[model samples]
Target: MRIGCRQKMKSIIKSFNQQGFAILHGVLASACIEAVKRECEKLVDELATKLLALGRISDTYDDEPFEMRLIRLYENHPSETPTIFRRELHLRGFFELFAHPRLLTIAQAILGPEIRLYPNYSVRPKLPENRRTEVLWHQDAGYTSAEADILRMVNVWLPLVPVNVENGCMEFVPGSHRGGVVPHEKDEYYLRIHDDHIQPVVAQAVTIEINPGDVVIFSNLLFHRGLPNRSDHVRWSVDFRYQDATQPTLRNTQGHLLCSKKHPSNVVRDAVHWAELEFQ
Candidate 1:
């Protein structure tokens, strides 16, 4: 059953507050979508060119038989990695997508009035012919050690292209939040530390197909992952996590400073880890 606008917004807010996830369908209008798509294409082309010039395009460690759109230029060329955002290319314009007013407003509403922006922001592009491994299901918390209760972190996933179930869109287990942090399977991303079920209930599955510019909001504790991209076109998206001012943070999380108009201010404390870190 379709719902009225006011009711829909209320439900969305409520759902996110309770379950730590919410999908705002068609959040980005067509024009903004086009703008982001074009910018992403241009950035991808630029990054790819640089990598090729540097002779760094071998095969990604996680590289399987899948078609790869973006090859983690920074991951391969860590020496050239930018210092601005989390493992990002130091591309300011591209990182701006995280702080887009509409995206932040929704995050602010859920994370509380004051939030601190993590310096870590990134873009994931699943290119045509890039079909290797499935983005194993996991929670954002699996990558961090922040306080679970006081933390008000929200990850905003903005798709640069239309996302559908067939082409490896994200799938969420509705009400999975009630289960708390389930143990995850340790693979390439991060190993499951706690003893939780590997397979979550499929009956509650809800695949979200978002158009360009649409944003999906979810917490770090939610169980989610990107499906395999089977489409001929590339699937591109960016992510940003925000924490409430009262929560703890990783000082060197991604090894970047946490200050940008595009970043949030709601944070708790900041810490650092010397061990190698992957995406958060």
Candidate 2:
């Protein structure tokens, strides 16, 4: 079974290299997923409480289901609601997911033993028909400044609920990363690849339909976009990058080291420690 598992990961790594992305089905434990969900619920509770005090929300929507609560909360006042979570993610559950050994192994295969959890980690709740949540077609590299070529990164994404064309699932152009970073023009909400650069291969894009506990890893340069969420519930997902620790993050904040042979002491110690540390 160990050999079989290793072989499967080998295949996934190969696919990731050639196709610019690879999906690993059922790679996460149900307990791990539940932990993150609990954390998200806690965050929502906190947000609801604050909003109630500030007169931003008439109702907390606490009785709503996890997938529906946030969407319902913001339905009346979308502008006041937050769509993305960053620093607030330093919870025990999120730490367990981010520092998971299996994920770190995959990161190590691609980025060597030294790895850092990149500073761009985010948890997004895509509300139904919200323009603020619809991501445009662009390479992850395109978002970075001059470091687009230097930052070695692989992005990992998974959905809390099953995702498809209806709920803002992502689509990727196969082998698009090979072309490197393409020119991206500024859109109102996000940067989009210039039409001249993406039109030819855009038709060949594959929709990434995935379920909870399924993880998809893609290159930083992969051409990708998220469809609008037409479903009634919020489509929640977390994305984080693992970087080769040897290179400079090129930002003011240095991300936490997840693994390292030389700087073993600097590695994030445990879930409790992760929760204690603030986003840097």
Candidate 3:
């Protein structure tokens, strides 16, 4: 069984190299899927209960000021609160999803066995009309200028919920990875989304959809975005970016650098060691 899994993973890695991305259908076993579902559900229930107790569920952020909104919730929230918004939420038991045996094997094939976490693991849950935060078409490197040019980053986007085109599924321009880095403006990103900055080298744009337990691995340089979720339901997915350990990360405002790992061996390293970029 283990050898079969390894062979399948090798094929997926080969496909990823040929193309910029590959979707592994039903990569997670049924038991693992159920475990993830239960863990996420429990987190929601706990959040609801805590909100009810402190009247924070629906109104906590409603009255807060802009600076307050920008405050890092991962550090501010009680340690018990499940970290949900990307960088800080190191979903404890959920490590299996990112470091799954088969998934890591495939990653090893692409990134070498010495794979290092990108220090920016995040879960983006786009609630219906949640402030127009859909990322525009741009290379992920444009967002992480601190890294060297030779760096090859891979983002593994695993959706806990089945994602489709209408519900903010990821859309990519095929063969965009071949273009490498393209100049991007601050206005074209999360702040003010636009397509004029992204030169379309690939004539056809592909909408990627996946079921639960499926994973989409793509080059970070590929042009992609979380399309606007027109549906009433929320789109939930976690993006785990990985790169070689020797990359340089940018420093933050507090004189502290991010992703500065000395060991870079463990999957659960602190955030100060991962590379991060300013969101303009």
Full-model lDDT for every candidate: 0.58, 0.91, 0.60
C-alpha positional error of residue 99 in candidate 3 after TM-score superposition, expressed in Å:
1.4
lDDT of 2 by residue, 1-280 (tens): 3998889879989998999999989989999999999999999999899888989788998899999998777777887667899999999999888998888899899889999999989888898888989999999889887557778887999999999999999999999999878899999999999999899999999999999999999999999999999998899998999999999887888989999999999999999999989899
Name the regions of candidate 3 deviating beyond 4 angstroms.
1-11, 56-84, 146-148, 188-199, 249-280
In model 2, what are the clashing residue pairs, if there are any? none
Candidates ranked by TM-score: 2, 3, 1
- Per-residue error for 3 in candidate 2, Å, reads 2.2
For candidate 2, the lDDT comes to: 0.91
Clashing pairs in 3: 86-122, 86-123, 259-272, 259-273, 259-274, 260-273
lDDT of 1 by residue, 70-90 (tens): 535445444443211234334
TM-score of each: 0.69, 0.97, 0.72
lDDT tens readout by residue for model 3, 1-280: 5898768776776666666788888888866666555555545545555665775444334343311221222224433333256433444445556557776666666766556566566766655444444666667777766453467667788776778877788887766677666666676335321355454443577888998788889887777777776765657777876665454444231211222335444434432222232221
Q: Between prediction 1 and prediction 2, which has the larger lDDT?
A: 2
RMSD of each: 8.2, 1.2, 8.1
